[model samples]
Target: MNITWNKRQLELRERFREVATDLVAVGSDARDRDASFDRELWKELAAADFWRLQVPTGAGGLGKDGWDWLAAMEGLSLGARDLGFLMSVASHSGLIRLLLTAGTPEQQHRWLPGLTSGEVAATGSTEESGGSDIRGLSTRAVPTADGGFVLNGAKAHITNAPVADVVMLAARTDTEPGAFELSLFVTRTDVDGVGSGPGEDLLGLRTSPTGPIAFRDVRVDADAVIGGVGEGLTRLYNTLAYDRILFGIIVGSSLEAQLEPLVRQLETRHAFGAPLSAQQYMQEKVVSLTMAVEGSRALAYRSFGQLEDQHDGYSLSASVTKLFASTGLVGSGLDLVQAFGHSGYESGSAVERNLRDSVAFKIAAGTDEMQKKNIFNHVRRAYRSGELAPGSRGSGT
Candidate 1:
């Protein structure tokens, strides 16, 4: 409940903000227009050790804790003002988190160096069946006689799939099953029988490379399995929770980035007989944006603390954070566009691009419906347990 960033966190935040503004934000518009992922910029961030913020020191990382990492990422998102690029960062961070959580020592030793050094990594979970319907995935991994497995499956609409150097894949492993049993595997994209499709042209987040990845009888040793056999569901959700938490953080910072432009527009733009700032409606829009920035960051920081402490309520908090952040971001995005009028609606304009990018927040980590379902389930449990009392500020934990 401290609710304040310490000096170390503040320093890291400002440092990353400067790095992102100098290296990534400069060409964000161009990257979005061309649907390009700037590998050079990505490398620059890696060189700056952005990915190592939360990694333990023994693991060849900076050994910073979760709060510090969150602060730095907040600055990165705010300064860069490129949700697409940050989306890619979220996906990559998920991979790093998964490895940190479930990877064996050898597994970590094999992957963490390259991963921490800027090698692009992805988690292949969503398939053609859709992200929400993970239970319906058909990707199969049949075990071999030599303590290995042959993987044959495809993941679609995966962030970083088109440009990933390594992938952590989830594949069905149960030969006889009513409910699917899945296992996670680490695979290199350059291996034989592995193929990646070209990036998809999307409505928003165009700077992130997102596409399909397929494994055709791709072979991996027993060591490739993450955590254990038939244990992917838990780990998958853990990684997802991390990503969902990230969306909340990104929403907070991205909205903060919009506030300045929104206020400037209202202050300068004129209509009728006076400046738009003279209008109460325009002032309300600014207030909405400010509220969203504060609300999302508060929820995100709370969820992050729970997650870092390994609290039981972490998952629920993450869901709530993502849901609220996505809703606020999209709503505020629309208000900003409306406040700026035609110029905001113009293609390539910051507000126009931001509004478009904000739409993906609802769909990316998990749909708004998914978060609602999670929240409802949590509430139902709390209600049944007589824990849903009035004036209780708990998150139904």
Candidate 2:
């Protein structure tokens, strides 16, 4: 239950905050209006080694651990109000972790350097059928005689797909669709038959360009297979498990950023012949939001600690953290908007933008319903196995 950060973690947080401040200073609302991802800003982040934070030193990364990674992400989110930019960075980190964990040595050597250097990488698992249902994906990858594969499918709502250099694509290698039939391939976007659709007009995170990618007879060698044939589900699940926890911290940090502006407004803006902060209702709202932010941070840190400890229930813990933190973010965003009154509802306002950004968190990684289902299934299995005492009503191991 120790909640203290060491010197290194504190120093890293400060460094990330400084980088975020510099980036924010150069950022303009034009990026959001244009729905563009700033290549120059991404390069700045890369030069700062933000992309290398999760990578291993031997692989040309910063060699930081999970806690450090969370700290960096949280700090970056707190300093940079651009949720879309942060989302893009987080997605690249997830792809890197997948490659490092499941990729072959040759594959890692070929792709890790570029990915860690902030050359964008994307994951194409979500299809038009629905991202939540993996078993329903229709993307097919037929094996060729030349020890390669011809992929034909389209991925929807792919983050950073518009400008990604490499994509970790999921497709069905078997005739029948099921969990075991899926496989992952690292497909180069520059190859023939790889097409990207126009940028999507999303409600939020507009700066992080998103679009659909079509793979029409896209060819890749057998060496492109990640982990192995029929291992896509396993690899994907692992990636999401890690991503859910990390995203919790990101959302928590974003919530923290919203608090300061809110407090400033309350302290400076007079209402009913006094400052808003003097009102009991305003004070209550601030206290509630403060508690939510702190709770989210605690949950994220605890789940990460469980992961580092390799606890048996870490998967469930991650799901819980993601579910709570994302929903909490959405709630807190709404509260902040209400606290800001009319100014918050103005176009391009920070609170309005944050609300839009926070809503996406519920859908990304896994939806709120999906997390509930996962938690339910885990609890059911534990209870049925007598891991939980019949009347104890406790979360079983």
Q: List the residue pairs that clash in candidate 1.
A: none
> Which lDDT values do the candidates have, in the order given?
0.89, 0.82
Q: Give the count of colliding residue pairs in each prediction.
A: 0, 0
The sequence of per-residue lDDT tens digits that candidate 1 reaches over residues 253-306 is: 989988888888888888997999999988999888888889888888888778
Measured on C-alpha atoms, candidate 2 has an lDDT of 0.82
Top candidate, metric TM-score: 1
Estimate, for each residue in 264-382, the C-alpha lDDT of model 2 and write its tens digit. Answer: 98999997899999999888878877776787778778777776666777788889988988878888888888989988898888788888878888998889999999999998988
lDDT of 1 at 18: 92
Stretch of 10 with least lDDT, candidate 2: 388-397
Model 2 error, position 28 (Å): 4.6
Error of 2 at 203 (Å): 1.1
